[model samples]
Target: MSLEGLNMLWQLVAAVFAGLGAAGVGLILRQLSGKRLPRWIVPALGGLGMIGYQIHYEYAWFDYKQAQLPASAEVVSTETDRMFWRPWTYIVPLTTGFTVLDQSNLVTQEAGEDRLVEFILYRFERQHTDMVSHQTYLLNCDAREMVPLSGDNREPRYAELRHVEGSTPLFQAVCPNA
Candidate 1:
């Protein structure tokens, strides 16, 4: 899948989790308060918490991804700003937010003792009626060349290249601002 697809999937997952959280909170509230709190408030709080977690994950996602990598791996470059969403609100006109790692695609090459990996970042913009999205890949590793391995819908999915011997180090530059 493309990075945009991944971002949308993650957003949907987050929203679902948020909905569940809200319902759970409501359930707890109902159990605690016999009179029952306002019907909307519980859901509102849950939504807020869910969005907050999703935003936090969006910003910290790179770090999380990097931590999963090996210590010898070098991030040559990065991509950013690939997906986004806006939900309606009573107090405001629209609430704009973003999703990232849209393509979830990477290219890796070898450089002697070190391995280089390239990451592609996708971006999406929202208008009143439509969403505009695009993609850019970053050669963010020590490797000189990265080749795409597989993809569909004109989007490169997996890539293969040479990697430096034992260069899979824990990635620190997981997320790069496109």
Candidate 2:
């Protein structure tokens, strides 16, 4: 199984345990009150606990993954969204994904007036199953342009080439002197 599969399985297991613990607390409360509390309170509390755990996990996932990255990885950008289904996000947007640039993998080349830097960009997204994807890119420091490179020959995809702003973290990280 993939790491994402294992993580999902662990989440399910943890949610079940949370429900069970909350139900146990409800039972204790009932007992302490001489059974005056309604029996429905036990299941209600269990459901609440399961939902609470899921919400906490979703909100904390970004920070948890960020902490696990190596020092060489720099977060270039983050994606946040507010979905209608996730109404709480309207109050505070949820971080659904992020892009990272690995400084350790950067390869710089100087040819006359042009300074070219090659690096890999890693993208991580949260979904039903967490997804991670990477692509190699070539950047021109002087022109502030970036293009994705193809396999083996490192052919640049001019169709996808785009100008990068100097103020962006990606540009700043790759072309510090520029």
Evaluated with TM-score, which candidate comes out highest? 2
Candidate 2 segments exceeding 4 Å error? 1-3
Looking at candidate 1, the ten consecutive residues that score lowest on lDDT are: 169-178
Candidate 2: worst 10 consecutive residues by lDDT? 1-10
Residue-level lDDT tens digits of model 1 in 40-89: 76777778878876566555655655564455444444444334353323
RMSD of each: 11.8, 1.6
TM-score of each: 0.38, 0.91
lDDT of each: 0.50, 0.95
Clashes of each: 26, 0
Model 1 bad stretches (over 4 Å): 1-7, 74-178
lDDT string for model 2 (30-110, tens) is 999999999998999999899889889999989998999999999999999999987889998999999999999999999
State residue 50's C-alpha deviation in candidate 1, in Å: 2.4
| Top candidate (lDDT) | 2
